[model samples]
Target: MPHTKDELPDVLYSAAQVRALDASLIAAGTAGFELMQRAARATWRALVRQWPTANELSVLVGHGNNAGDGYLVAVLAQRAGWSVRVLAVGDPQRLQGDAASAHAEAVSEQVLIEPWTAQSGLRGIVLDALLGTGLSGDVRDPYVSAIAAINASGLPVAAVDIPSGLCADTGRILGDAVHADLTVTFIGLKVGLFTGDAADVTGELVFNDLQADPQLLNGTAFTARRLCIANLPRLVSRAPASHKGKFGHVLLIGGDRGYGGAILLSAQSALRSGAGMVSLSTRPEHVSPALSRIPEAMVLGTSSANQLMGLLEKVSVLVVGPGLGQAGWGRSLLSTAANAPLPQVWDADALNLLAGGQVDLPKGCVITPHPGEAARLLGVSTADVQSDRPAAAHALSKKYTAVVVLKGAGSLIAHPDGRLALCHQGHPAMATAGLGDVLAGLLGALLAQGMEPFDAACLAVWLHANAGEQQGKLGRGLAASDLIPAIRQLLEEQAPCLK
Candidate 1:
């Protein structure tokens, strides 16, 4: 949950965007080889800092410029009195331009170099320079065996730029990927490093701008911006004469016959996150428990679509579908809510129902969908959704004209306006149930308080993920309710009520 690269940049780039940034730097008078050498020096500095006691270096090189960085790291390691060896996974003779020059420099420095065999003895801290960002297909051949060996070695490892076999554009692992202990990435941070199967393989992340001019870094195009405290949307401080009615009222609809807890969690989160008033419309059986748990919220036992008509008119925001089953009663309520023209937050069964084409998603609302739910909505397999999450999020945003919160390790918030933001904050312990419900309600609360859909989602995701990270430190068995208090505290810290 600890963000190793939080000190880096808020901007995230696709593989091609970073390449263009690199090209612009070269075109601006910084020689390509000079940039490579700077990258090597940055990697060398990070390697020594990560494993100070290790004096041996075993570097794996591919045919790309990534290999060029690795070869240069070998030369720097040799000069620093470390035993260094380069395992040529990609033929050194195939190196071009700056990469070929890097190979020749390695040879001139008397660095020990050899072809990589399956039996190659990897010594010291292994440096994975095997593959670079251009990889578009599944891993192949000697590199596969090499990656397998690296994973099997159990030695401390560092990757130059990115871990070999990790798609810089998407976080998908191409067939296989190297698991590194420390990944020293140069220039810009790749969006792939935070999402999908990325967290499993990308260990400690470190970024170096390689001394690129600040103007150049700011001028390039990027895929998404990282959501952090500095860039998160803030709510206006309340006036001293402010009243509860001044803030918007929030209505959370869900909780079928047997699934009442999910909706309660959402309502509870909404109540605590500063909604002026919170309401719950659920089955008659849940009325007593809802009132007993959240006496602050107005709980109504709703059995038919007509029961929600009056309540829908009174609420300012709607949080739909937390445990909303697809039964006739639930469907009736959803159909009613769908036509209310309120700023809605759809999750869980609501998304499933939407995917079933039973109701159209309201424009400009927010839809929070996990990968499986996203696949259903997109009419594709979950694998397809995970393979390229950014694309899926973008597609959903465009299709529904809604603010889409694609929830996962690297949660993405995509706006209909083409603005995308990623939240890298979260804990592994947060993989439990009811979390999405909590997020949906929190987002609704933010919206009720007058934040725009995209702004509310970005802030809600950041707060929820950071709260999960904080509570997750207590270690496993993190309940969905555990995040509510933490989120309230974080919201106060982010945007104080008085000031």
Candidate 2:
């Protein structure tokens, strides 16, 4: 697992797993109150580091351990001579065990505890310690009003652990959620913090392990591992005397009448990313332009399934669907590829075609789909797919018995064996058209070079996102073609070929 200064644990845990960890800590001779205090002290240190000069604090306390963490943070702030106030949103009388002790500590420290009111003039850095990971339904009552007030304040907020009203299991926002400027999470990272709306809501993420037992963590199950360059499999170093035949061939099947650029981008990406031989089977009208754009690729003008048979036999890997239309020509070509014994990468229109039941997917293939395409594949609405992207990706992989890449904010790659990985390195600029094609081609190139479908998909997503991040720094006007050269540079930088 790769750990950056600003990144959380690569191993993501669900709400239940996190609770079990917390319970295990208590069972391992550490008192629950002591653990709560440690969380508070950690949050306090983060708060002071983030805003050293701010002397005012407004802590929003709910009824759980999350609220206990906030109360202790308020006490720490008050003891340090800072003006700290706690708005107890939940009934303080109901707080039990660690939470009850934390409340007493706050009172003993002379921190002002007040009830949440509509007219409360919330100033200073607000601490959103309201709902946490255990919430299942819509936020009710004064808590809703308090959440609304916090959003309207326009003040920077520091969320303790997970943000309130955001599902820690899925990235779904339950009715309403706090949009924090910085969220400090403890123990293991949660999957919700990196995908869907969580990406937008969780501004700058900071993680604190709280000195938990590494042996205990190693023994537990994780939801997914975060994708990074360190985790990707590299192509084997080629010998100096190696020929073109040694690198394997990739056949790109796509490009309808007016969509030649899509297939051209995929071929270019594959060629640049170290595929030994690249071929394109597209509409007759696209062949000339594709050849003109990338002379390295063996462009074929094929309009029927019969024309694709010869090309299919020569290639080791197939990357289908970039700009494949829903016309009979596209269907014929796809049908032929479906029967090929080679490893395959399916993306864009190919996914759309599969969703429409045009053809069955080849075994040991990879399917990359955005939320809409994912919905089509699962026979559900787009909302259902986005609501639980990890579940959707896993379902797609199992249903097709192939690797599935669910592309969105935090792109997820899932395998049929119940293994999953996520890439949270991309920028918003990567949401442009033809980017998916570039990714498919990159994955195809990896597969041709002898990587398994799951490993290739994970590596391709990380490399593509890293390239997008590099170009994203230059601002807008980033084209899909811009990522190819960037990806080539990144691949060499991360995993140099020692020929």
Which candidate wins on lDDT? 1
lDDT of 1 by residue, 1-499 (tens): 3356568788999999999999999999999999999999999999999888989999999998999999999999999999999999998989999999999999999999999999999999999999998899999999999999999999998988888889998899999999988888878999998888888888888899989999999888899999988899999999999998978899999999889999999999999999999999999899999999999999999988898888888999999999899988878889999999899999999999999999988877899999999999999999999999999999999998999999998999999789999998899999999999999999999999999999999999999999999999999999999999999999999999997
TM-score between candidate 2 and the true structure: 0.98
Residue pairs in candidate 1 whose N, alpha carbon or C atoms collide under 3 angstroms: none
Off by over 4 Å in 2: 1-7
Q: Residue 200 of candidate 1: its Cα lDDT?
A: 82
For each of the candidates, the C-alpha root-mean-square deviation to the true structure, in angstroms, is: 0.9, 1.7
Worst 10 residues of 1 by lDDT: 1-10
Q: lDDT tens digits, residues 234-286, model 2?
A: 77787888788977899999998888889889999999999999999988888
Instruction: Write down the lDDT of every candidate, Cα atoms only.
Output: 0.93, 0.88
How many clashes (backbone N, Cα, C below 3 Å) per candidate? Answer: 0, 0
Colliding residue pairs in candidate 2: none
